[model samples]
Target: MLLSFRGAQHLRSWPYFYYRQKSHFDSAILLSNPRNLSQFSRAQPISARAMSTGRGALIVFEGGDRCGKTTQTQLLVQSLQSMGLKAELWRFPDRTTPTGKMIDSYLSSRSEVDDAAIHLLFSANRWEKRAAMLRALREGTTLVVDRYSYSGVAFTASKGIPSLSISWCKAPEEGLPAPDLLLYLELGAEDAAARGGFGSERYETLDMQQAVRRQFESLRDGSWTVVDAARPRDAVHEEVKAHAVEAVRRCAEGLEPLRALWSREPLA
Candidate 1:
């Protein structure tokens, strides 16, 4: 299903986005390389449902630019599908939209703009996708987001703006749909540099990225797990799968509703 809601105003408040109670399901999918997601094969029954709503859980894989988040997210999607769960993965800055096009220009240095202006544009990009994201959540499909509001705040604040704390930066995204589980891949900036630095995009610098890592650690709530990304992909996927399974179970148990994760509160 597709939802068409647009405009700059935020639709929900922080409390609504961050706190709420919901059940979690216990299931998992494992993955290999990006294209070779067939490394593992297994189909579990949709045999598990919390309250018979049969809704698929929402999970997000978030981290710095070169943290292998894409690979991990794909693996998770494959694993969920293998288990008979309907899952979908989405990447932010969806360059497909008009707002996203603007963001893309800024990221690629094709356009010159203030740091703060671009920051809000990123937030707007997420906002534009708000309706569709919520629809996915309600449609019994496992939603795996490669990046979400978390990246918006962390990356922007890392830009060294004064008076821009995590809370301040994230206020705009408050009230946005909350994820049942947020996997924060942990890796040193140096390792990320070794893997690949900024890919000709704004906010991909080593120093800025290091700062964003710090910001992410601070904004993290209870539903997040920080896994080591300094090892092999298989090892990282193993760790992600274990925690992901537990998180799904927690969501099934009616874990606290995320009061809300995103907001459009005016920057204070």
Candidate 2:
């Protein structure tokens, strides 16, 4: 027996008949031996409201420097569009805003910057983009963000700020937005060093980046995947796409906008 879904689980009106032997989520059933669904089954249509909760998945890719975040983000965005889905790509520290310019200067070593100031600035960058990000998700746009609040915390914490624990650093972004899927691209310090020389900027030192990588790892939990950046870009991309697609399927059932960054939860 086999079943194929005719429409969306709750949004589309259809009679799903799961085969006693084999079936798919499509709600259609095929049987090696015939079984009558209409005659001996309860087929009822469910409303769209009851199918799922939450909105599109908020996916963030964060890691140490030069982790192929931009390339992979573009791939995901283009792939999603090829699949006829509405997808948007956003990169943090947008570099278009005044605050972002300051950050760019600090990163380029063109200007002196206070560590604490840069930390908050990074947080502010995300905060500035928060509403747009949320609106995109609410409108059923799958958002692919490269670097987010995680970068703020991880990068800042790596700089030896006494009070800048990950949690402490993230407090300013508590109401920004939470990512449902976070992919932390992992690469060895030596590998990263060999790929390219660090930019002539503050925090671009090898030791600093290694420490930043450590901080990134410390923040890793079930919420993220440590992709081996040492692999070929395509191979890493395949792994990321597979995991991301599964996550998207699981999240699409709800299709409602989420308020994770603003669910009124106190700072962790």
Candidate 3:
């Protein structure tokens, strides 16, 4: 069954029956099979306080360098789209933006930036997309994001800069949209070194990667789903797909108002 929002005039094409709730937003819960109607009937209508009638799940992929986060994000987005769900792929350091261009220059070693400044630039890169990201989710476009604030914190804090504590690293990211599912692609340091094109970028060295991994471990919480990326690609994709599908289902039913990341507590 699919959950979507549609105007009354546009609901005639499908054989499915939907329970319509009229609000400031026209929200419709569509059940493909009539039998499911009873189940949906017993379910509570989505709260009016939600961002919209329905919002897409934010699924984030995070891990050390060369841990297959990029590959997994693409595959997961493809899988969701193939299932007829709305999904889009997003990534951090969106290098096309002006702020991102500076970050790109620093990461590529063409220019040097202060460690503290570079860290904030990374966070700013995401801050620039905050509005659009929220809009996509509210419009039912599930986002499969590669890297995020977690990467900013993990990579920057791994630098061991005296001023950049874990809590300080997390501060700028406080108000960003939190992911419904955070998938951490776990790979050993040795395995990550063996991956092709290792050390091609600023943070790809073994020592740096190891440090980043330690930082990620410290940041992990109960909300994270750790996947063993050493397995074959398809095997990892199956585990990711299962979690993503469940997250989407939960969001479609009703998502709490978008929450701020690390708003209430400092990272340990």
Could you list the CA RMSD of all candidates, in the order they appear?
A: 13.1, 9.5, 8.7
Q: How big is the positional error of residue 53 in model 1, measured in Å on the Cα after superposition?
A: 3.4
Tens-place lDDT per residue, model 2, 9-115, is 33133333342222223222222222222321333321222223334567888887777888899998876666545678889889988789988988887888777
Instruction: Write the residue-wise lDDT of candidate 1 on 80-105 in tens digits.
Output: 66655567888898898998888888
Error of 3 at 54 (Å): 1.5
TM-score of each: 0.75, 0.75, 0.79
Off by over 4 Å in 1: 1-52, 250-259, 262-268
Tell me the TM-score of model 3: 0.79
Worst 10 residues of 1 by lDDT: 11-20
Residue pairs of candidate 3 with colliding backbone atoms: none
Cα lDDT tens digits, model 3, 62-129, are 99988998889999888777655688999998999999999988888999999999999999999999
Note the Cα lDDT for every prediction shown.
0.67, 0.67, 0.79
Poorest lDDT segment (10 consecutive residues) of candidate 2: 27-36
Clash counts for the predictions, in order: 30, 7, 0
Best by lDDT: 3
